[model samples]
Target chain A: MSSLGSKWKPVIVMVINDRKLRFGQIAARIHVISRKVLTDQLREMVEDGLLIREEFKELPPRVEYTLTEKGLALLPILNLLEDWERNYETKEVLAEA
Target chain B: MSSLGSKWKPVIVMVINDRKLRFGQIAARIHVISRKVLTDQLREMVEDGLLIREEFKELPPRVEYTLTEKGLALLPILNLLEDWERNYETKEVLAEA
Candidate 1:
């Protein structure tokens, strides 16, 4: 539960699923999160064994994140949550209408 | 996911699932949470349409909370999350040992 405790972690996992992305790319995708918070969350995810951080030796140094097996296991649960949220939002809109 | 954005909300939902429990009872069950935080989270749950708060004209003005249809709908998802978490914890413990 600690791994998914942060609101942004699930979103991050979804964003990075099946693909590798650099910090700036992830930040660009989730524009609402501040850089500091995103950095903290990503580090926590790595510590929690949900993400792997790989650094490549290059001129400016390249780092990317990918989901570990544990993180991949969470995809279905997050998908279920996302589906539930979508339906709930639709109902809310209809009710308001 | 705003409804469940707070970690305490899920735990509260689990504690009060299928049963009408008063504020004090809920507080007693999840003793780690302070009364003020519990009150705030309960009110947010009510606003999110995940709980029904009932006021009873009793000696101390009792207030009890029960899950709404939406909240009940979340139970299965939470159950799945709980299962995943349990397995994860078990693996972590085994790895450490």
Candidate 2:
């Protein structure tokens, strides 16, 4: 979703990939992101159909964020990103080609 | 890199990948990024050894930017990101497994 841009997309997608998490839980993983920013990102993801938000009729209200099929589809890409970052940080100037 | 985080890193690295570009040139490629933000991103790329900046003495001054060996190393990964984004955007809710 190149046009559907968000700085934390990769990070958030990678974290809540397989399992669903409530709002606060998701926010906790991506340290330093503001509530406003996370909320905005989540809304965009939902609109893009990348994530599904399910609500429960509980007392304080409960909403769980889970990767839709579209979101799950992003895992491999997110994996690639993680591997790339990992290698980029550890490896020195790369060898030819 | 994972620990060395930045929002614009992927975009900047993708643009100035092969050929070098001046500050203005790089800035133009990524629309809406402020010069200050671009400058900050570039400096970090240089510090992280992902980009090289060369300067020359002239009337108006001259400088160019290009990906380093490490940065070039990022191409495949960036390519993967692009492909992933493209596919994710185009494909419907992915088929299972």
Q: In model 2, which runs have C-alpha deviations exceeding 4 angstroms?
A: A1-7, A28-37, A91-97, B1-7, B31-34, B91-97
Best by lDDT: 1
DockQ of all predictions against the true structure, Cα-based = 0.66, 0.26
Q: Candidate 1: what lDDT?
A: 0.90
Worst 10 residues of 1 chain B by lDDT: B1-10
Task: Give the CA lDDT, 0 to 100, for residue A83 in model 2.
Answer: 74
**lDDT, residue B79, candidate 1:** 89
Q: Write the per-residue lDDT of candidate 2 for residues A22-81, one digit (tens) a residue.
A: 999998887799999999889888877789999999999999999987678778866766
Q: State in Å the error of residue B47, model 1.
A: 0.7
Poorest lDDT segment (10 consecutive residues) of candidate 1 chain A = A1-10
- Score residue A70 of candidate 2 by CA lDDT: 67
Candidate 1 clash pair list? none
Listed in order, each prediction's TM-score against the native is 0.96, 0.74
lDDT of 1 at A37: 99
